[model samples]
Target: MSSSFFGDLRVVLRGARFRRLFGTRLVSQFSDGVYQAGLAGFVFFNPEQHTSAGAVAAAFAVLLLPFSVVAPFAGVLIDRWPRRQVLLFSSLVKAVLGVVTAVLVAQGAGPAFFVAALLVLSVNRFFLSGLSAGLPYVVPRDQLMMANAVTPTCGTAASSLGTGVGLAIGMIGGEDALGTGIILFVAALGFAAAALVSLSLRYRELGPHLEEEPEEVRAAVRNVLRGMLSGLRHIGDRVPARDGLLTMGVHRVLFGVATLMTLLLYNNTFTGGGVAGLAGFSVSAALLAIGFFAGAVATPWATARMSASTWIASLLATAAVALVVFGLPFSPVLFPIAGFVLGFVSQAVKVTVDTLVQRHVDDAFRGRVFSVYDVLFNATFVLGAALAAVFVPPSGVSAAVVVAMVLVYAALAVGWTVRARRLSATCKGRGALWA
Candidate 1:
């Protein structure tokens, strides 16, 4: 909202290194959006498909839960490899996988279709961690927070725009196998574009320097066994970073359930299970996109005025209140408003946590910690969808789920307030830590 905030964006984008890196992220995430939109259309929005809560839960678990298990390995390698190379090869792999996935979708949105898509999505997580891990190298520490604020938000906005593109493609493709396949093929092209963009960054330009690389293959194996623990220890007892992880992981669990309910409600209950359902859900997605950008715009100014803990606590509490206010009656018109509010809150919290980790964790362990971050993020979301399967009805109207999320948000907010006050009372670095 302020001229100075716009000034900061200009400042961060001014560098060639940052520009190349930023361009890579934007292009890759746009592909992510396009890919996801195609999947959603084939799996959920297709009239021939009969979607259930159990099916949704199983789909997410199959796609994400395995990825969560193997993610640490990717993290360890990311720390060992040149990040730019990781970006390049991962993009190349994902592009090929994207084509494979498109072919499977054309056959039918079958078991293999999900599995192929999972491979692409898993590589996406690895690529994203490398981006985050390498970010500190491109921007000054002083500007890292602003960089986090800008990059993820813009990336998400690109994803949202890509979703719009996917939707338009889906229209031409007509929500069938052939249509979804065409959309996915377009997404694959986007990945190829990302690979080309990544070439602009020199090898090892974003990295764990040569001295830090493991000496041998056996050492790499040993590193994998111990590296996760090292990353966890590195984050230990630093209240802001640790609690930030906990809050975000929990938030995703609750939000994931909410997302399931929204999808089911729009498709089965609100819009009557056709193209209309997807069109309605797109409204929520669009609102969320706007909210993400709003959060990025608001965070720097908000954090500058108050401690990160206070700001994050206020956001969690606001989500609780917003869920109650807008989700109570489960009105079709109101859920999108709730989506916008929670989207803003979610992105703001993420930006804060990213800054917390970037500022607090050592560079050597950043990839691992962020790997841990991704595991928690994805795992909890699956847990939420699983919980939804058990509790939320197919109709997606569940007062119980609404009540549960509010309580969790309220509890997390209280915990944040108490714990932060205690930590600030004793921490020597509290001034820097909380800021």
Candidate 2:
């Protein structure tokens, strides 16, 4: 494998299938950013909506809990259906739902508006799961790490760019119900464009390589639980991937708490909840993009030289120290830097875990594994937010919450380091197995 990130990219992007899949991810996630930003403005910055820790938790639950509900079905179905078609059709559904969501947003922020938004995001879960499951089909098995790094980082960058554009639309249109609706409608067009791009792929372009006959709907529904358990068991047997996932779950919960805290800080204490708060939010978003890009660039090169476990342990430890050093102050200058650090940590860990899962899991269960991964990602985050809502203030300044995140990061770092040592001891080719 190449030590240089660009070298890995040059080798991997040479595949036409990879490029098509990568393009689909970029366009779809970019639209996701726009949709998320549109909703964020309405829920967090709009004077009309209430901004509180409890409210933030409620909004996250409304948007994310449904993603958990759909994961089992999505996993089982993705394994049965063609992944290429999954991306194409899911995008189409999202486009239609986005329009409906825009119409609802114009009626004012309510349960109906959130329901519409969540529907768009729920459909998005399918599109995203397909991207992860389909990646191994596109790239060389040897360079999966670089592929993971580049695709998600670039998708996130595209999403961040879309966020700025959406916010600009909201601002131009007055940042009200009508403005937010316009932003969402424009975002819907992006989804349509994504669907158009996905048309380039052949029917079996991205595959589960299914050898068995398709199961009946009732049978599949009954099998969802069985399938997920199978996935979990499969993961448990792949020690490295299972450990990576456990590490990821820990990061998500801490990250989730920090996320709500940031929302509250921006909405209330940091800027007093208006365009000023939005600007601060935008700055953090931009910094996050930079951090993600840096992490992406760094991971491929760094992991080329070190074990994946070592890199992850280091990053988690860095997160613990960075949070206390930069976040304790909670000054505008320091907090954004903290956001950047966490962003980098997030991408690096995720890129590692994504590669581990894809590398270890069989194609037959890949979709199901990624979908269960979907549940692990969102469900844990929501769990964290719900737990934090009990204590985090509207001002978003909770020394105790920050302390909790720091301690968790530290503990996870130690645990991962010890596991890396164990993997090294038990495996003949430790680097090859873990990395």
Q: Which ten residues in a row have the lowest lDDT in candidate 1?
A: 213-222
| Candidate 2 residue lDDT tens string, 189-280 | 99999999999888998886665535432243357777777777889998778988888988998888988888888888888777888888
Local accuracy of candidate 1 as per-residue lDDT tens digits, 1-435: 222557678989988899999999999999999999998887777776667899888888888899999898788888778899999999999999999998888886567887888899899999999999999999988888789999999899899989999989988877578998999999999999999999999998898774754454225435786877777877895656887888899999988998899889998888887788889999988998898888888998888766788788889999999999998789999999999998999999999999988888877778888988999999999999999999999899999889999999999999877766765676555364464
Local distance difference test, each candidate: 0.87, 0.85
- Steric collisions counted per model: 1, 0
How close to the true structure is residue 218 of candidate 2, measured as C-alpha lDDT?
A: 29
